[model samples]
Target: MRSSVAVILATFHLLLFSGFCNGGTVGICYGRNADDLPTPDKAVQLIKSQNIKYARIYDSNIQVIKAFANTGIELVIGIPNSDLLPFSQFQSNADTWLRNSVLPYYPATKINFITVGAEVTEAPNNVSAMLVPAMQNVFTALRKAGLHRRIKVSSTHSLGVLSRSFPPSAGAFNSKHAFFLRPMLEFLAENDSPFMVDVYPYYAYADSSSNVSLDYALFESSSEVIDPNTGLLYTNMLDAQIDAINYALMGLNFKTIKIMITETGWPSKGSPNETGATPDNAQTYNTNLIRHIVNDGGTPAKPGVAMDAYVFSLFNENRKPGLDSERNWGVFFPDQTSVYNLDFTGRGVVARPPDANNTTISNGTSWCIAVMGASEADLQHGLDWACGSGNVDCTPIQPKQPCFEPDNLASHASYAFNSYYQQNGASEVACAFGGAGFRTSKNPSYDSCIYATFGANGTTAAAGNATALSSAKPSSSTAASSGSDFGVPTRGVAFFVIASVVALLLYL
Candidate 1:
């Protein structure tokens, strides 16, 4: 018995560790190009309130750095392209900038990466030539301070750096940027830093909607596209984009270097020509992206490798000089109210406040349905919580129950999540099972299994006017972005239960 218990315990711990390792990091980009943005202190508070663990800023603003001190959020600071020339010409300039900008708050602020420049290849006056030198000088300053290993040095690049990205396997860096890019790639590889690039599947689809499907770009594709050269299957555009970068890196014989998404997001609003840039699309893309990364849904080229990404702009910067989409990538408005519901933790859908007007569900009535693409593990977590602590009446989902046929985790979880939501007043908060549940106006009732809903007399019922409700389904297509199922492995759950019992016995 003791040996069996020990084995069970070991298995439980291994599962837990593997799950942790597989969940990649998600961070937000803090751009302050707006005139009406909140102060740094308030911004930090807002970030923390959302349970966000990481953030990246455009420049080394002292006020912003100071505000993040003692907050425990991992920060990535930057250097503008204009400063690259001065920093490259003189090592002392780099040292001085570091001293004034980073040295004081560092360990307290949890500063992780120092981006030397932003898209230097796109900058005027051939500033790209100075990128590597600037990075080297900054790295040297950190080394002198005994902080080289603690703070990584790299630069951010746009997808334009790649000359070709179609089919992903054919990705290659532009020869025009070869002189500087090669050396920079070498520096990144040698120092064990990631090749940071801004990947926007929105652009790929927006520029050529005829060739690229919105479903593929938003991670909602029920179909897969096979890369002919590598024969690797691509379910989403983001994965294809990253793999293209990976192939580009491998072509240079830099296989060991990792890739990071410095900036990526969809706009809630855009110009008339910027097709598919609606609030619904933005919400779907970002929400699914968080789930993809946190669930370790790596690209087809590197399926096992975990990737980290920072969503562009925490707040919409109205002053940004570009298309209207550029000003609307922010997840939250300046007032700190989210532009739409988003769960930063990648667990379940975040519930919007009652007063908020961005919800997709109609004001009349709503039902909580299991989001289509939620992973099996996520669905299980939500289901367990709903049936257990959520005080949901899950009797209808058991064997011999009306809802048991079609017998799958998705159907069962939907019934339970909806039951909980209806019983608890059908508020958005009740439906939020960590991004696992979404509110829908369409009735999910079939044959004998009727989903519970709040009645007119303020009571919950298992029956409702199925046809009277809206004919449109929930954002099922958008939720299908992950294409994840609702089945949890039974062996893992059994191990967890056994381990728990053994732990309690030992404690007694």
Candidate 2:
């Protein structure tokens, strides 16, 4: 009887919060694209333990659906792209699939969304054409079963469907796919279902690491890229991607259709070339992502609009094909242990206000270095400022110079900042490059690039021809002579004295 009541309560929570929640709701995608995985019951237990309110699965697996019954976890189920053709061809096929899969345990299981096709636009067989028809048939089947209003139907799309996404405000769907996408948008609008998108900054960063900063991709950057046209300042890539999709939809005159992030996660491991696929990076990305969404601050283009997102997967699928990153998006290993610690509730890593002052540097030997986790753009910004305003000699970081062998922004910035800091008596003001600079106790001297350290006499010699600017604060005194008059003496005459004499003469 106690077990029965627990199940009933779980069911109640699922029913109430499946569509919307009081706090920021994050879901997990339980993809079983591998040979080894636990049974549905054990997976459900893990989900419950994490206190996750939402979950999405690749298929309408009967066992998984039944396992979720009375657990109160709302689910977004998917229909594979291969099955889309059959569903699109005939309503009977859709009804059969729905009856065999979803109808048996929907409300009890808390199924709220049925994604007909996953990223169909990127499918090789031109499955994009069948997405709308399949969605329609699925909707019709749900209506027949008297569940259309409760369960929304839509297909997940990749950002590749959009021809332009850079400026966010200028995002537009590719003209080639617009024929099919337009009708699909209409169907979604008519049904009030969201336009689901699978957004991944990892892919964008991987393709163009030189131009895109890692901090921007991971939602950890203090710097922002503003869309000039819309005056929208985008601090992270995910929000920019979402706003791009929204702008695309609004371009088509479908302003009311909402957007949902059906899939988004970072891989914990990958090939040698996949530089950003480390476990630490994965944790940082996922954790920060949850906090950003839960804070209820939507994208700049669509302020205050709440978002619903599902992390890519539950467990890594070893059998999955493609690059190493392809199989490692899971938050947990196959054993159900989390790959990295995460607070799904978004309270674990509370954001602190920006430090008003920079890291303290005692009057001892120290090397000014780049702050860890600072973005490439941020490093560049600081480097430029150090070389320009800070007046630090950066010749060592130039090509053919000793420090140039390392040839990276961070390394160069460190060398330059250290030179400036040491020259300026290592003052606290000189070391703070808008918080991008950090004072390192350990020497960062590497192979050919040796950083400078302070001497006992409080002044250090130059590390090879590097010169430093004076640390003196410029006086605010006005220029000795105004440039307006050519060789005129303004100090000898007083305007007030001349005015007084003219007034006295006039009175007499």
Best by lDDT: 1
TM-scores vs. true structure, each candidate: 0.73, 0.66
Query: What tens digits encode model 2's per-residue C-alpha lDDT throughout 1-508?
Result: 5565555556545543432332246899898888889999999999988888899998988888999999999999889999988888999999999889987886789999999988877787878878888899999999998999999999888998999998999999999998789999999999999999999999989999998899899976768899999777788899899999999999999999988888899999999999899886787788778766664445778754678899988999998889999999998998887686565755342111123233564555666776654667877888888789878888878999877744456567777778888888877677777776777554455323456666778877566623321111011001112211233323333343345445654555
Please give the distance, in angstroms, between residue 332's alpha carbon in candidate 2 and its true position after superposition: 0.8
Q: What TM-score does candidate 1 get on C-alpha atoms?
A: 0.73
Model 1, 1-508: lDDT tens per residue? 6777677668767755554465578999999999999999999999997788999998999999999999999999999998988999999999898898889888899999999999887776779888999999999999989999999999999989999998899999999999999999899988999999998999999999999999999987869899999889788899899998999999999999999999999998999998788777887788778877876546778765778999887999999988999899999999887786676766443232222333465577678877755778988999999989988778878898767754567777888888889999988888888888888765565434566678678888653344433232223322322222233443455466667866865775
Poorly placed runs, candidate 2 (over 4 Å): 1-23, 350-508
Q: After superposition, how far is residue 106 of candidate 1 from its true place, in Å?
A: 1.7
Best by TM-score: 1
Badly placed stretches (over 4 Å) of model 1 are: 1-20, 350-417, 420-508
- lDDT of each candidate versus the true structure: 0.81, 0.76
- In candidate 2 the C-alpha lDDT for residue 5 amounts to 52
Clashing pairs in 1: 219-481, 220-481, 347-434, 348-434, 348-435, 348-436, 349-434, 349-435
